[model samples]
Target chain A: MIELCKVTAAYQEQSILENCSLQVSSGEHIALMGASGVGKTTFLKLIAGILPPISGTVHVSAERISYLFQEPRLLPWLTAAENVNLVLSDSEKTIDEAHHWLEVVGLAGAMGKYPDALSGGMRQRVSLARALAYGGDLFLMDEPMAALDDTLISQLLSLLHQYTQGKTMIFVTHSLEQAKIISDKIYLIKNKTLELL
Target chain B: MNRRWLKQVLAMLFWLGLWWGMAVAVQRPILLPSPAAVFLRLTDFIGQPDFWVIVSSSIWHIMLGILCAVILGSILAVLTAQFPLLDLMLSPLLTTVKSTPVASFILLVLVWIGRDSVPSIISGLMVLPVVWSNISTGIRNVDAQLIEMAALYRLRPYVMLRRLYFPSVMPYFLSALKISIGIGWKAGIAAEVLTVPANTIGKMIYESKLYLETTDLFAWTLVVVCISLFIEKIIIAALGRLDIQHGRKVAASDD
Candidate 1:
């Protein structure tokens, strides 16, 4: 579903990745594991069409992509349900889908609450619900569950697997256990390069 | 009412009590009218048809000015935010407007436009820079990560504005309104006073001063202050309601 050939990216004078390459087949789940600030997010951004590589080609076959940011990034004025519904094209089905996703995320009671009224974990779940309600073939998540608790994490891991079944997903995480649970293949970001594991 | 609003009301009453004490000490209605005297004068003024005509005209002109300024300023802000070159070109001109004295503009405007239009024009001019700058700042302050996500999802422009920009920019816009409305009132009245337009509070004030009716002058001044405070309180209350809806304080500086 995605390919990056000899990608070279930088932030001003400093290089984040050099001579890096990655490829993902259709419906394959991939995890990029790394320490803090190792450009895992950058690589994901490259595939997600947010960051253009300095000197490489990135190709994404999937036309529809849903992204969950590290921060919840919910609109402060929007209700939790509205936040999810915003991702969908206007339809009666969108409202039902948004409600369903909120229910799946354990926020059925919070549909009317704005992001400001939500706790951190609840906001993150709202973000996750937004991504899921979007109904895309490609999913890119950057440390999406970082703010979640262990119980919530396990619940979401199961939901993520169910929702992302037969879809291409690229996620970044710090935990090996999380990577193993979600990803069919794992890659570590280190020394300004992606190392297959 | 909130505690903060109650506290502000109490503070104003304390100052008013001091003013009443000072008026008692002076023991002269001409030099300094007592609060009761001013209140009585205000009641009489309110009952007059001429006073209503003047107040209503002033309200219409100033509100029109502010509306025009807000519309033009928001358009300018969006243009400037979208284009750096426009921002670069307009920065100095806006800064000049900000830095120049209000009296200077009023004088020049009085020459160009008639006295009837001066108050409205000056009020609009005074308000333009405030709305433009604050809205531009709000646009610049939008979160980068959210933009990235927005791009990845391919949100439509109107949807992007509704879902992102409105929430982010509303507080800044309200803060700009809170500040610029006062400036508009001040500039509008100053223009009216200088031009001596008919059916205006400023004209009444100018006439009272010319005839040495110090009590009337004090009364007019008190009316202006009261009206300004009332309008400001209403705007701030509406803004507070918006803050409650959005779930975040504006974080705008009071000044």
Candidate 2:
């Protein structure tokens, strides 16, 4: 579903990912982990076709991909329900599905609230709801539940497990338990390249 | 609300009383007519058909000017935001328009385009810069992340503009409209006074000054102020149809 062949990426003149290469087959789920400022983000950006590699190439075969950025990245002007609805293609069914997703993510009461009105954990949950509502063939999540407490994580882990089935997911996360639960393969960004673990 | 109205009434009465006292002190109608005389003149003119004709003509011209300026300003702002070359070339011209006096524009345009086009052209000139600068800033200030999201989602360009750009730019555009309306009125009237259009509020005021009728001059000036306020209210109400009406008073307190 995705391939990066010796892809070197950078911001300005400084190289962040040097000769980084990875491949994920169809229906493959993977977790990418690394130390702070180790270019885990650049790897995702390359796969998602957001950043151009300074050298080599990137290939993504998935036509529909849902990406949950490290930040919630909700349109602050839009209500939580509206933010969820943004990614839904069918306008006629969007409202009901948005409300349903928000409810599933434990944000039923806060659907009308704006991102600024929600707490950090609630905002992340709303973002998760948006990604779920998108219903894409592939998912690229950057620490999808980093803001939630252990209790909330455990509660919502079922929701994640349910929706992520039969699709490729490349999730960047810190928690080993989270990586283990969701990923079929784990890789670490070691010395500017993906290393299988 | 009642207390606020009372405070406003008292403030108005204080000024009106002071004007009456000054009129009495002067005791010369030609030099300084009493407020009563000006009010009488105002009522007399309101009864005349010519007054309405003149007022309506001025209103039509100014409205056309404002409308044209808004359309052209929005187009220019979009182009300038999209192309660096356009921004570089157009910046100095707008700066010159902003800095140049209304009288200068009146004289130059009167000579170039004749008196028929003066009021509308001058008014458009006054409004264009304000609208362009404001909308340009609004376009430039859109959140980069939202734009990226829109791109990734493959949102159509027009849809992206409607959903993201319009809502973001509305407050700035509305504010510019408010300021431009005032400038448009002032410059429109100034242009009319210079060019002496056949039927206009400025023509009536100019004639009053020529005939030494101070009461008529003051009455016409008062009429201009009233009309300016009325049109501003009407235009503001019209903006509500654009789905960005609340943007005028929008101050997001989201924390």
Candidate 3:
């Protein structure tokens, strides 16, 4: 579902990922582990088509993609349900779909709350719900549950595992435990390239 | 709230007492009328049917100018933000308008249009640059991450505008509106006074000055201030309601 061939990504003139190559087959779940500022996000952005490689190629077969940014990035003016609904088709059913996804993420009581009124963890959950409600064939998440408690993270991981059954996912995380629970395979960024572990 | 109101009342009374003392010291109503004399003149003017006509006519002209400025300024800001070439082209013209004195514009506009239209044109000119500058900055300052998220979701253009752009720019837009309204009113009244348009508060002020009716001049000036404050209150209240509708907390004083 995703392929990269000698992709070299850089910011300005500094190379973050030099000649990095990776491939994931359909319905594959992969976890990317890396230190801060080590180009894990750079890799995801390349696949999500947000950033272009300075060298080589990247191919993503999925038509629809759902990306959870490192930040919640919720519109301050929109309620939790509305933020989720923002990614969905504008229909009455989508409203219920947004509410349901928020409930699934344990934000049932916060469906009507604005981003300012929400805590950091609550906001991240809303962001997660928005990504889930988008219903994309491929998901690119960058430490989406970093703000949550361990129990909530486990519950959310279980929910995510059930939800993304037939979908391709590449998640970035710093926690080895989370990585082991979430991915079929684990890859770490070592010296500006992916190393399987 | 009541304590605050009482404090404000006391402050106002202090100023009035000082003004009365100064009027007595001057001993010339023509130079500085007492507050009571001005208030009595205002009451007399209010009883006249022409008073409402004059007030309404001035309000209509100034309000028309403000409305036009708001519409055109927003359109120009959006277009210029979208097209850098347009921004480049209009930059000098807006700068010229901003820098030039209001009196110069009033005279220039009077030469081009009728005296009655001069106030509106000058008012619109005074307000346009402020609105354009603030809104364009607002557009530029919208959170990039939010914009990226919107794009990744492939949100429709109108949805992006209505949901993302509108809310982000609203605070800046409201700030511009608040500021420009005061400028528009001041510039419009100054234009009217200079041009002496028919059936306006400016015309009455001018006539009172011509006949040395200082009390009438004070009363007319008071009317202008009152009307300006009233209009500003209405606009702010309306914008506060809009903020509420968008689920934003409305600050008591956005300024």
Best by lDDT: 3
Q: Best-fitting candidate, measured by TM-score?
A: 3
Candidate 3 structure, TM-score to reference: 0.95
- What's the number of clashes in each of the models? 0, 0, 0
Worst 10 residues of 2 chain B by lDDT: B244-253
Q: For candidate 3, what is the DockQ-based docking class?
A: acceptable
User: What digit string (tens of lDDT, one per residue) describes model 3 on residues B111-169?
Assistant: 88779899899889999999999999999999999899999999999889888898889
| Arranged by lDDT, best first | 3, 1, 2
lDDT of 2 by residue, B212-255 (tens): 98999999999988888888878866875564432222235243
Model 2: CA > 4 A from native: B1-34, B244-255
Which window of 10 residues has the lowest lDDT sum in candidate 1 chain A? A85-94
Candidate 3: clashing pairs of residues = none
Deviation of model 2 at B135, angstroms = 0.9
Per-prediction interface RMSD? 7.3, 4.0, 5.6
